[model samples]
Each structure stands twice: as structure tokens, then as C-alpha cells.
Target: MDSSLIQRGRDRGYLHADEVMAAFPHAEDDIASLDEFYLTLEEQGIEIRDEEESDEHPVPETPPSLLGRRLGSHAHRADPDDSLSSVS
Candidate 1:
């Protein structure tokens, strides 16, 4: 799986250690931890998906879009934002 996608899943509470390990088999090659994943997402400006309302783990529908992922019961990728990392 894509790092960005894995990051989003973790952010959305969908990533367990095994899930993360399974999602990105190559994470051991570079990424060190889930926190590191968040750090990279912050540095790379990737949007983390929300799971409160969205279950699909939707990604930004558009390329390089800044709208962030809008996940209703129907999840749809719009654009990404830096705000996701700050959420509690």
C-alpha cells in the first residue's frame, strides 16, 4: 500500500500495527513507526482521512488537491490539508 494511504488509515483509526505492517510491507525499509508516518505526512503535506463518518478510508479524489478527503457515509476524495494531523 501507498505510504500516503497507510498514513491516512492510521489517522482514521483504521491502522493497527499489523495493519500498518500489512498495508506497507516496505515500511521497515524506511518508516520507523506510526508516529513517523504522521511526521512524514506532515512533511509531505498529505491529508489524513477521517473515520468518524467515513469507513471506506477514502483518498483525495483529485491529484494534488487540497480540499482533503470528504468522507460522509459516502466517502469521496477531494483534496488534502495539513489540518488533519492537529485533530484530537
Candidate 2:
């Protein structure tokens, strides 16, 4: 795995140290947040990578809630072939 990915994983809340330590049984208690690890890597002259493939694709934040409770409701409507079909 790339150091940048490890740093990014740590920076984001995705990687839980205590959970990992508990699961692995051999993991150490000494742990640092992603941001902290990033600093250490930077001091070592490690290059930061942009994981995103392109700048055009924006990262989603709002989530799919705005789409309503059911995602395929419209598609499952009576007139499935017609885009104008409405699902109750």
C-alpha cells in the first residue's frame, strides 16, 4: 500500500486504531491520527498523491437522501419504459 494512502486513511476517520488492535491482538497502543502521520511523512520528504483520478469529478458530500426514500421507485412504476412514470 502507498504511504500516501495510509496517511490519507489515517487522516480520514476510516481507520480505527483501537478496533484494529483489538482484532489483530498483536497491534500496539501507540497510534497517531492520519493528519499527524501526514506530518511525519512530509518531514521525510514523501510526496502527497491525489487519489482522485480527475479534477472534473467532484466529491459527494450531501449523500443520496435528497433522492427520496427509494432510489428505484420511479423505475419500478407502472410504465417502466417511460421516463415520465411516477411511483407512489
Candidate 3:
């Protein structure tokens, strides 16, 4: 297990399960080793995400209603005569 790989994972805040498995192939079939690997990752501040959770669609931190409120607030700053401003 290279420290650089762990550092990169920490910097990105996450690594897919496959990435971890690929980096530490010996841990694959050993349940104890796998658990220790996960703990080490957690200690290093790296989140382990399943490959199914692709980066293409990141989870939104803000809820939709809160997002709407933020956009609405910005809309109020737009010119009253702006055509888009008339939209509800």
C-alpha cells in the first residue's frame, strides 16, 4: 500500500471499493485484513464508496427547496424589467 495512493484518496475525500481492492490485492479474500483496510482508510480520512455511486452525479449537499430559496433570493436582485424576472 503506497502512502501516495492513500494521500491521493484522502485529498479527494473518497475512493471506490475497487480502487482500494486493486491497491491492496492481498486484503481481498481475508475478512480481517479487509476490515483493517477499511479502518485504515477511515483513519486517513478517506471515504469508501461503492463503484455504483459514480462521480458524474454527486450527491447534492443542499435540498431542492433550499436551493430554490437561494435562486429566488438571487432573482430578486435582477432588474424588474428583465423578461425572466416575471417568472414565478
Q: Could you say which candidate leads in TM-score? A: 3
| Tens digit of per-residue lDDT, candidate 1, span 35-83 | 6766665566554534353455457465445334433346655566746
CA-only RMSD, every prediction = 18.2, 13.5, 6.7
Per-residue lDDT tens digits for candidate 2, residues 1-88, read 2455555444652334433333335324433454465465556554443444223455676557766555556655455565644444
- TM-score between model 3 and native: 0.52
| Model 3 steric clash pairs | none
Question: Could you estimate the TM-score for every candidate?
Answer: 0.26, 0.22, 0.52
Model 1 steric clash pairs? 61-77, 67-79, 68-79, 68-80
**Highest lDDT among the candidates is held by which one?**
3
Give each model's whole-structure lDDT. Answer: 0.55, 0.47, 0.76
Candidate 2 wrong stretches, greater than 4 Å: 1-32, 51-88
Instruction: Give model 3 RMSD, 1 decimal.
Output: 6.7
